[model samples]
Target: MFDSRHIQTFAEVVRTGSYAATARDLGYTQPAISQQMKALERAAGTPLFVRAGRGLRLTDAGQVLARHATGILSTIATAHGQLKAITRLESGRVRVCAFPAANATLLPATVARVAAAHPGTRVELLEEEPPDSLRALREGRCDLALAFSTGHGGEATDADGDSDSDSEGGLIELPLLDDPLMVLLPAGHALAGSSRVELGELERERWIAGCRHCRGHFVAACAEAGFAPDIAFATDENLAVQELVAAGAGIALVPGMTLPLLRHTGLVARPLAPAVGRRVSAFVLEGHETAPVTALLLRTLSEAAADMERAASGSPRPEA
Candidate 1:
């Protein structure tokens, strides 16, 4: 019988597309990963991978094995989660992945509540972007992920269209809240005094953008308003983005969750005219939803999101 570990390693190789990456992810040496691959090939009696330029690509047999391995691993994880739930959440670790904003604003309070309530159950955080976090969730590297989607068609929704829980693709998405993208401008900027600003109005202004995806979103949002942003600075740090705006370098588009964490008061945040936003949601493998620890974390996150919504509602709006 092929060892399940070998199957898991093979699956990881498939997901990561490099033996070295798989080794790093699994904490194994590259030679060890090669040995496992060789052993797996011996058991299967066929070559499972081939060199494709600088990286490895799966062969037909490898693809077939990967499909089966995913299901097998998911089943094993479900069984493990169910068994751990039998202990009534006394112990066991839940690996969570989230984006930066959620990590800063949403996850801390929720994780604190979890730790205080279940001291024996450990929670580990991995900061990743939404796409990477979802990939990690699919590959079994994380039990839960806090993710967000923007754009008109990208919003997560159910069939009935009222809720955000997407019950498709063997995953569950629990919608938390909608975080609107707001315009950030220096206090003395030309349009800073406006209650709301349209993207087209800032076409000629220098812009500060986040990472590549965020930059793309900014450009796209501008395109929707019949203009393109002249981005002058790029950084993944939201604080740095705010700093740049405050220093008169450029303006920015920031999500609402980040507003509560800003230490700078020299910038003004105005609502966008068209109201572009992202939907924040919790993602889990379908079968693990009912696991005691997972359920507990979900409840904590839901409550935390609700509290944030309430706080945002009552807080004074940002002014120029």
Candidate 2:
């Protein structure tokens, strides 16, 4: 393998035609320049220089190597610059896959902050729920995935429907926040004015479910409350869920992260009695958490989650 330092010295010597001149120009001793040339020539397995009347001149092999040296040096310099840029967070790309609720709230804030902090960094956003997002992370389709899981252990399912434990599935999870699920009710409903509602309180009412995983989580919660909900509609779209609840189709349970995006005047959201919610996390393939772009995105996401928590604390109620 050719050493880049030797290539640099060899190129300088080729340009100047004198070891002393090359050494002086590069702020190295003449002996050091000679040693570098020797190492470079040995690596090439050929004589790179031959005696001339008063100075050094490139032999045929040396000339060929010299012709290619320019490109090699350029490539090395370009690689160095790019690595520096990435380490400094001055340039890079972070492909993020997040669920719809986070895409509506946390993701936008995170993207804006990343752009403002690192103008040269690019963020590519993809929307997918936990199962699909986890799959994308494992398949190397995304740098990071913003996914949610029922706080219960091993509740997060992956692409193949396997449970996502802390160390299972070659994933690194960074738990961001616990997003409480709120019950969405018609504004005219008797319990709509209440500050909080129990899961059993809505068990008799028709339910509008969410994604497959969300529906499962809701069903389990309902079972814990000693009843099975009669799901009248199922969709992953938050707006549709809000609309259905507003139109008296069925009450829905939605994450707190999504409340800001749901503003139906005919609907009201109240925190669940026992505080049912999902734990939102950022998932990356093992060893990817150290990547500069991924690390930056993760930090920004943590900050955004903190901000959301602070804002929610100040005003716990979600306006209709």
RMSD in Å for all candidates: 7.4, 14.8
lDDT of 1: 0.82
Per-candidate TM vs. native?
0.71, 0.67
Q: Write the per-residue lDDT of candidate 1 for residues 1-320, one digit (tens) a residue.
A: 77888999999999899999999999999999999999999999999999999899889998889879988887788566545434433357788889899999999999899899889878889998867877677666778888877754433222213444545545687888889888989889888889889878888899988866566667777888988778889999988998899999988999899998778889889999878887788988777788888898999999889888878778643443
Superposed Cα deviation of residue 231, candidate 1 (Å): 1.2
Question: lDDT per residue, candidate 2, 277-320, as tens digits?
Answer: 88888887666678788888889999889889878778553443
Cα deviation of 239 in candidate 1 (Å)? 1.8
Off by over 4 Å in 1: 1-90, 152-169, 315-320
